[model samples]
Target: MCFKCCLFLASLAFVYFAKAFGGAYMKSSITQIERRFDIPSSLIGVIDGSFEMGNLLVIAFVSYFGAKLHRPRLIGIGCVIMAAGSFLIALPHLLQGPYKYETSVSHNKDVNSTESILPCLSNHSMTEADDTPDLETKTACEKAAGSSMWIYVFLGNMLRGIGETPVMPLGVSYLDDFSREENTPFYLACIHTVGILGPMFGFMLGSYLAKIYVDIGSVDLDSITINYKDSRWVGAWWLGFIVTGTLILLSSIPFWFLPKTLPKQGQEQSESKSKSTELATVAEQENFLPEENQEQEEKEKPVTFQELAKDFIPSLKRLFRNSIFSLMILTYLVAVNGFIGMITFKPKYLEQIYGQSASKAIFLIGILNLPAVALGIITGGFVLKRFKLGVIGAARVSISASVGSFCLLAIQVFIRCENAEVAGLTVSYQGAPQVSYNPQTLLSQCNMGCSCSMKHWDPVCAYNGMTYTSPCLAGCQTSTGTGKEMVFHNCTCIGEMMTPGMNTSAVLGQCPRKSDCDRIFKIYMALSVVGSFISACGGTPGYIVLLRSIQQDLKSLALGMQTLIVRTLGGIPPPIYFGALIDRTCLKWGTKQCGGRGACRLYDADAFRMTFMGLITGLYFLANMLWGGLYIKIVKRQKKLALRNQAKENGQEGNGAVNGHANISIAKNKEDEERTGEESTI
Candidate 1:
């Protein structure tokens, strides 16, 4: 039986890992998906929130009713559904044609040699129709209509959410039911610790896949002008989804063989001997009576739909009556809102604020940040188990960790890298670096001869370490070399900005940020790692608080309700609002093939940092405040429960003492009667 329990734990752990892998992979691909579909961040947020939407539809019923069924089989079914969703997400990539990036490059009649791209030489001024590629053909509009393929991704993610509904509430409740009370925290911690690895590998997979071009096999990589550093670059995002899908499919197999029910660990002897007293002792000590026991009690009476329906509302009422649970859920909800929003766009933040490539940002998160989180989670569990912390003790540890991390997180608002110095965006066209974007400052007398279209984002760096929007905008009359190796010569803007003797040529891609920025970036990452560890240290303990505070019989429904509430209020709205706000800081927006506005290519660094970090800090502040209230409620409730238990024990002792005295008095009377009879007989 213990062997079966161990098997279930191992299987559930792997399932946890698989599901986390899928979720993290989704988060990691945010920027890639955004660029690939030419969608805005706000739309990406909607897609991200679709998972919660799916959960919203069916979580309540599944959590409540599914607990009575075979949990492992349900979990297996969930895994299969998740796998299907993953595969569905990858379907759009195959269905769509090769990705096309907007470019200023054009070939000559011979097709081998490149033609001059000097718009300055043309007599006619360039118009929007001339620069817009998607509007050139009616056929392109038809293809653009298909660009709503993001809907498939949305639905797939939603399906994944629906599939994921059972895994947490049912699986966790099942484990808690069968495992020893002392062992539950460590077991949950082990599962979560293993689960954290999923995100690590998922993000690492994202990092590795991001370096490869999206259309790698079909097209020659040498022909592509931009590298992964380019904003327009779309990586192999679909490939990771397929890989994760396969892993999930494989993880489901072991769960199917697991039994529907298991005996409570460490109580098998009492259970086998059918000793009422021993069973009663174990039940009395536990906060929640396992579902198996409840089932055995009700097995003789066939349950009806009306009875089940009747109990539902009353069960919900009993759960929420505990003020501590309600406050804890609120605290968790606020914290999760910040967390989901922060994570969904964190890669983009690193890429934008720190001037890191998408691949590098994801890599750092996987290698540095996620491992810290894993460590912190295990540490929290070990601390709880090692210390054998009661409710009050657990609250102390959780609150301390949260408060410490919140303090560290607030410090992050001050640490930020300056915006990339670019012509027209972050600096004057004359090569003076500035802090804000001023589009009107893009045009100058030096490049006045060239009426370049500002629509396309083909960034090029001049010799003076200034980045122009494009070679045409840089006033480059000629270009040499091809692809990523290309260089622009006869650049009037560079010459005008630089001294006469200095070089006038520019090269492909934007200039790397200043050395100071690199130093600042390192500091930011170091703080991020430390802060993540601190924040995560409370995760296991905080979860334990939630698990222990609820009534045992309602554990599954309580967890499910918590998920529903958290996902609905916390998960659904953060990303949308966060993205919408972040959209306001855009310095440049990518143009879509359908002549519509697409993804944002650049953002004002200072405004972005303030907006993003400020929101997170504010949410954390509110969460911390709620945590304080929750702690007070927990302390008071525990004390009250302890006092009530003490009073009951004293009452029982008093009755036992009175009964003992009465028995002694009866024995004395019997002895006197026997002595009198002996005297008469003598």
Candidate 2:
């Protein structure tokens, strides 16, 4: 039995691991997906939130009815569905022939050709008709828009969410039902611990994959102009889905063989009345009952839909009537809003605000931050179990953790890096940094005759520590080697900024941030790690408060309702609104192949930092405020319950003392009467 139970646990853990890995990998690949599809952050946010919408559609039904069904088989079915969804998410990569990025240069031309297509010289010959795209291009653009391959990813992710709903509620309840009460927590902890490792490996996988080109085998890597660090780079984001999907499929196999139910663990030694005792009492009642009573006993039937419907409303009311439970849900909802939005965009934040590559950002989060969270969760559970904290005690622990983490998070707003020096965006053509610029500002004396297109975003780094929007914008009239090694000679704009006798050539790609930004990034990461760990330490304790505050019989309903409400409201809206707000800070938007705005190629670093961090901080502040109120409510309720119990105990003791005195007096009176009767008789 123990071995079988262990097998079940191992299977469940593997399923948990696969799902978590897939989810994290999806988040880690957000930037890649955004670039691949040429979509805005707000649209990507919608795709990300689709998973929650799917869960919202089916969570309530699954939570209530799934327990009565064969839980293992149900979980197995969910896994298969999740696997299908994973495969579907990868379908877009197969359908979309190859990613085509906007560029001004012709890579197909020979590098050794004597005749060079100089961007600055060539711009003089471009007429009005040449600027407008032809009919073929317009038709292709219409076709691309009609296809909208990202819908597949959204649907696949939604399916994954729907499938995942059954795993947590059913699996946890099943384990609790069959396992010994003392061992349940240990089992759950083991599963969660193993589950956390999935995200670690998932992010690591994402980091590794992000360094490789998206169309790796099909395309020539040598011809690609962008490196992994470039904003336009698209990694093999779809591959992780296939790998994780297979794992989820394989994880489902063991569940089919497991029994629907198991004999309660340690049932033989259990002091409480067991199932067999109840059966024996029923047998005795049947033997002694009258014929009509026997008939009535026979009329006992299986529970029907109407009975369940009748019970649900009152159960819901009972669950919500607990003020602590309602407040806990509200606090969690507010906290989760901050958490979801922050995590979804944290990689983007690192890349824009701190000058970290997407790969490096994901790698750091996996190795440094996620481990801290794992440790914090373990510590929280240990502290709660070791100290055996009650509802009020748990609330205090969560509040302390929240306040500490909030302070640490607030400190991070000041730890920021300066904006990157990009020509025509953050800086002028003459090397002067500016807070804002218009499209006309991209033109200057050096590049005015060149007529550079502001829509194109082929960045080139000049010798004078400045980045131009393109070689033409830099007034470069000379050739480049090829791809990443390409460089332009006689850049007029670069010469204006350089000292006399200095070379006026420019290299491919934007210039990296200054060395001091690296130091700032490291500090930001350290503070982030500390804050994440501190916040995670409150997770398990806060959960315990929710569990303790609700009615025992309505525990499942309460949990299900909480999941539905929090996920529907908190999970779905945060990303959309956060992404929309962040989009306002885009310094340069990428141009699509069809002559429309694409994903943002560059963001205003200062604005991006303030917006992203400010939104997260404000949400956390509100969450902390809610947590404070929740703590106060828990304390008040605890005190009232304590006082009420004490009064009841005092009243019972007083009544017992009065009854004892009355009995003693009655005994004495009987004895006195007996003595008087004896004297009279004498």
Candidate 3:
């Protein structure tokens, strides 16, 4: 490759890294944004889908017209737009006030001692004029609570989708056009290998940032009631966006200086020599054919818009007519839908199923799973090149990896941790599975007289191992300590345990599940990493199959169309539907101070695992079925073509032998006649 090609490759790699970083960061921060905005999972799903909506808007037009335009400059413009979107996403963090997590525990020392008074008694001394909820107070509170800053995140993500339009189609096509054919796979693999690192780093960044409080620099750590493990905890999710945006802006600069096109490396000279040799051989075999040369030149002429428009329908028709290509697209669509849904909610699933904190989940996925995937992709590409695999070999590799991954996913369905023993949701106060759910079920005889509001979700784990809705619900007569260390004493709920001389105190936190659950979680993560690695090994080969199946002229359009369909059908809907389904499994919902439902605080683990893994497994099963059929078709066709070529070669050799014998016989006859005439003259 020339200097410009090298620069273009580097620029494209940088853009890939930037975009992947931003996208993965968004995924990693989904839980934080949900908690910060006090939105439901379904609504967060819609916000996530907005990015794909923006992609749907301009991808087709950009992909088609970009081929005729300056591809490098266009990609640079896209990077700038992406950077702007990232900045927009982070804007809400700057504009919004400091993060205030929802908590029922009073910040005042006096309020913390309210248990000294009878639980049912209202303290006149505590009531003040400003504390009264007058009409003005209500209105002002509503105004402050109604801050719809989440809209900024949605719009910013959408802008990111629009900005990302040119990166894949234009960048890949430009690279393919300039590089030697054999080197294309390795080049792409290197780009993707570097690109995968972006997500790895992005998720790691998310994990690191999640550990710090959202108001880290401004707030006192002692005053904060929650830790990173708390469901209500909100981290500095916006920081990664700003960092990625800056990198994207920097990545765009080099592309501006790079040329629009570069000569194909090494192949141009060889191709020219081959063409000249073929023409000379043709001239010796037959008279020079000017008409054929003119026709070949005409075929190479640049297509006008009018001509292109007329042929557009025909081109599309021809593209879909290829059975292998169409099947590949379908299979990819199914696989993408499953992959998108799984990745979008994997962290949340881990939190709910395995009783892990969001930070821990994101961190594990970043450190363990993403690197495995990156290695798998690189290995897949290397396998393809090293083995010199054509379509059939690539198909086999793709199908084998996919099926192997699916089998591991199936195993995950069996190796699951049990449901969390949350009070009155999954399990009864008696520490047994509940047959049915009712809000009134929370009102056990122990604390019904305390008049606790079921809406308040201040859980306290009693000495008996059962959790209560709040310290008030636990009928705690006294309290000690403060913040996270605070404990409630003389709890009536623990008294119902009927244990002789047991301490009847409850602490200010949810009850943790058995340690066996943690062991199960570790096993699950191990299986997850292995499955991810195996599945990702198919990615490069599958992509190569898609690229090779299409006509060279329509490579950009084919890729653009594939993205359009997969993103529209797969990207936009998976998160929405997955979130909506997962929302159904929520056992406890958080409440906003402004009198509305917030994010889910707890989930039924069994139901969540079943739904999440079931959906993924079903989609993969379908995709594998399609792959099976595609593999059969590809192998049969390849075998037939091989036989046909072999037969043609045999026929050509036979004809050459006959022609050689005829030339030798004529030469012998001419020599023999000359010798006879010379003897007669003598």
* TM-scores vs. true structure, each candidate: 0.90, 0.89, 0.87
- 1 versus 2: better TM-score goes to: 1
Total backbone collisions for each predicted model: 0, 0, 0
Candidate 2 runs further than 4 Å off: 109-115, 125-139, 144-147, 179-186, 268-302, 647-682
Model 1 pairs whose backbones collide: none
For residue 159, give model 2's deviation from the true position in Å. Answer: 0.7
Give all candidate RMSDs, comma-separated: 9.6, 9.7, 10.5
Q: What local lDDT does model 2 show for residue 207?
A: 93
lDDT of 2 at 271: 33
Judged by whole-model lDDT over C-alpha atoms, candidate 2 comes out at 0.80
The top-ranked prediction according to lDDT is 1
The parts of candidate 1 lying over 4 Å away from their true place are 107-125, 129-145, 269-306, 433-438, 652-682
Residue 476 in model 1: lDDT:
86
For residue 32, model 1's alpha carbon misses the true position, in angstroms, by 0.2
Q: Write model 3 residue lDDT over 631-680, tens digit each, in one string.
A: 99777655544544454565642356644544444444343222211111
Residue pairs whose backbone atoms clash in candidate 3: none
